[model samples]
Target: MGPGEVAAILFGGFALLIILRVPVAFALALAVTPVFFIEPRLTPLLLMREMFKSYNAFVLLAVPFFLLAANLMNGAGITDRLIRLSQALVGHLPGGLGHVNVVVSMLFAGISGSSTADAAGIGSLLIPQMKKEGYDTSFSVAITACSSVMGVVIPPSILMVVWGGLMSVSIGGLFLAGVIPGLLIAGSQMLTVYIYAKRRNYPVSVRSNLRELISAVTGASLALVTPLIIIGGIVGGFFTPTEASVVAVLYSLVLGVLLYRTVPIRRLPSILYDSARFAAISLFCIGTASAFGWCLAYFKIPAALVSQIEMLGLGLIGTGIMVALAFLIIGMFIDAIPAIIILGTVLMPVTEHVGMNPIHFAIIGVVSLSFGLITPPYGLCLLIAASIGKIRLVDTLKDVLVLLVPMLLVLLAIILLPSVILFLPRLFMPQFVG
Candidate 1:
């Protein structure tokens, strides 16, 4: 079959399976079956081989370890401490609890590197409080889900690890690139909260006293050190990303078990189990998605598509916008990791053709995919938040879209101005970024 024929079968089968509600990992694996049977050169065994090869990478080890760290933080009551700090820092703003939710997610994003962990940990605590404070239920869930997207956009991100490992971009550069955009997204969300609170007359928290701020900061000091350890260690050349993940896990254990004594020793087993379970799900998607990606590459589909797009003679900014739009659409349907493996590879040539920087392209993809966490169809974060609020997913759609406006603007900025992502990377990791 021609490359076009293979592309049709692969994407069509995957779309049908997704519409049928088959799990994404299974759908990806299943979608390639027809190509295997139809194309004489391919075999079913190749699927297993590609999946195994995808897992054999040393860098990918960071994924599970980072997940463990997030779970440890939640189990150890580190989340609670961060919440206290967020309250002290931002609670006096209009829509106090809403701002607190965004602030805590930003802080937790620094440590956890997992949006689902942020949503589950912060949403469980704050959603109820927001409701009790007479904040609209849908709005509370929407804000929680939206803010949680920062987890993946900030440093120590699982998506960045996958993108770097797969695309051969610098993990440190990607980490640094994420900082400004993540903070921008957080700032925009806070502004949205301010507007919402003003319109609805949501309660504002009393401005914290100096003593209260100090106490909150002191309480969360250890937890705050986590991002520093993970990001600092990587940027300072003290360790690799994978090593940083292990360090994060060990530090979290020390804080939870030895320092705070909040997490009972007996709880260790369950935390490990949960972390392993989530890691497996994420990693499995990577395996299948890699296999699917392999099929596209084996057919030279990306090259063909690139040639077609190149014919249009699109400029750097135009190509960047196109890349961002593609990621946003794909992210709405699939998880980010697989999307990176499948789409990132395809677009790499397009970006490179226009002389776009790898770090700049990566930040665009990561920030765009972060939106998927809140959007529907595959909105895992939104689903988790809605479930926690005991509300239908549709109920939160209005608030979710409304809050996404500022985030979309930040995404546009990243696309239009490469400096938005490149500045920090060039400053901190000049060798890798250029």
Candidate 2:
């Protein structure tokens, strides 16, 4: 078989493994074996070496720290202050507290960096309150599911750190680029909530006076400062992303221990274990993907694919569209980590060839897959949101479909213009390159 044909078959086999529910790390290792055999540069020994090399980066050390920070915030009763603060700020709006949940989640997302955390913590507090206000249970769950996606886009996101690790991009720059867009999506989501509120003639609650506002802000301030501190330090050259994460861990500990005093000191051990456990899974998957990518590189698969694409003479915009669509489709089935790792091998090279910044492509790639966490039968965060809110998956799907247009438009803007991500990093830190 021809080289191109062989590459296609190997890629197909890897995808099939993911579809069959095989773990992503295993899928990468399994799919890579044949390509290694087919192409002489990829010895099994070299694949093992590649896997070892993956975690060799000091930047990758940021993943566990960010993850531990998230776990710390979640366990330390940070969500309660956020929820209370949100209620104080927006509980008086029509549809009152539902709008509050979205805004609060957007606010907290900067710190949590996880849709699962946003969904679980915010949904727990707001869903029941939503039902108490005479809102549809399904709609309540739906909004919670949708709003949680903000966690990925907001600053201090571990997922962005993961992207930085994979692509050698500036994680701080990525965080800055995301701020405006994240707020834009939050505005869109708030509008969606308003539409439902207006349609239902929902009653607005009035719980906040000036004093209450001051109190709520003060309460949420500690939890809120973590993101600003982490991002600011990274951008201001005060710390690397890894160091920023360590600072976040300390900051979160203060919130949980000295400031809030909700979680006992003894609880830190279990939280560390759980956070490390989750971090290990992601790291292993990334490592295996590194091994798989090494095999593909040895075979020169990506370079060969680029040659074939240029022969099509499709031009840059056409190729960008094609790549975006492909990532979206892949996103529907595979989780973001595996998708990024696999795409980093084949697709990232195309962007580089086109003179696109890896950072810009990373933003596009992340947003495209971020939508996947809300769609269909396999959206992990969506399922979690639904279960917590006590609504059926179909109900949440309907709400998510409403926002898909805006989501796609945002992705298109990132891909077509590229400046949506690039301009910020350039304006703030000219030296930073993805």
Candidate 3:
């Protein structure tokens, strides 16, 4: 059979499984099976081999470690401390807890590297408080969902690690590339909160005294250093991103056990087990997605995509806009990890053909999909927030649409002005562009 016929069997089967509500990992594996049977030269064993190959990379090891580190920090009482610190910094701002939500997510984004973690950890902490203070549940859930996306855009991002591992790009360069856009997104969210707070007359906390602010920061100092250690270790040549994950785990452990005394030794086993369970699920999706991506490559889907794109005569800017839109749409359906594994490889050639920087394209892809974490149908962050708020998903989406306006604007800025994404990478990783 021709490759097109095979591609149809693979993707069509994948879609059928998704419609049937099979899990994504199983859906991907099941989708690729019929193609193997039909091709005669390929075997089911090849699927297993490809899945194994996907996780064989050393950098891919960072996914679980980062996840464990984030989970540990959540259990270690770091969330409340970060909340205290955020309140101290932004509590005086209009929509006190609203601003606190965005700021805490930004700070936690540095530590967690997972948006769902951000929404769950920070949202569970603040959403109730915001509601008690008269903030609407939908608005509380909306801000939590929107701001948690920074967890992926910020450095030490698991999605960026997955992207770097799959595409063989520089993880450190990707880390640097994410910093500015993450900050910009955080700033935009804060501005949105300001506008909402003023119009809604949301309550504001009394300005924190300097001494209390110092106390909050001092209490949260160890937790605050988690991101610095991860990013510093990677960027300073002290370790690879994988080793940096180790540093994050160790730092969170010591900070939790020795300093905070929140993580008792007795709880260690359960924490590790839960972390392993979540990590297994994520890695499983990644493995299957990699195999699915391999099938696409085998059928030359990327080349066909590039050729079709080239014929449109969309120059670099137009092609990038297309990349951003495509990922945004796909992200609404798929989790970012698997999406990165499957789509990053498929789209790399298309972007490169248009003279776009790989790092720029990487940021564009990450930022665009970050929104998907909140959009409906598969908005993981939104689902987490809505669940915490005990509100329906559709109601929370009302506010999500408002948040998306600012986020989309920032995304457009990154797309039109590549420098926004590249500035940090070029500044820090001179060798990347060189």
Q: How far is candidate 3 from the true structure (C-alpha RMSD, Å)?
A: 1.1
Order of quality (lDDT): 1, 3, 2
Candidate 3, residues 74-142, lDDT tens digits: the string is 999999998999999999999989888888888998998999889999888899989998999999999
Off by over 4 Å in 1: none
lDDT score, candidate 1 = 0.94
Q: Which one is best on TM-score?
A: 1
Q: What is the C-alpha lDDT of each candidate?
A: 0.94, 0.79, 0.89
TM-scores of the candidates in the order shown? 0.99, 0.93, 0.98
Can you give the lDDT of residue 300 in candidate 3?
A: 86
What is the per-residue lDDT of model 2 for residues 222-296, given as tens digits with 9 covering 90 to 100? 788888798888889998988988898888888788877877989989999988898898889888888877666
Candidate 1 vs candidate 2: which has greater lDDT?
1
On TM-score, the stronger of 2 and 3 is 3
**Model 1 agreement with the true structure over 1-434: per-residue lDDT tens digits:** 87899899999999999999999999999999889888788788988999999999999999999999999999999888989999999899999999999999999999999999999999999999999999999999999999999999999899999999988889989999999999999999999999999999999989999999999999999999999998889999999999999999999999999999988999999999999999999999999999999999999999899899999999999999999999999999999999999999989988998999999999999999999888988899999999999999998999999999889999999998897679988998999977
Question: Which candidate has the top score in lDDT?
Answer: 1
Q: Once superposed on the true structure, which residue ranges of model 2 sit more than 4 Å away at CA?
A: 38-41, 312-316
lDDT agreement of model 2 with the native = 0.79
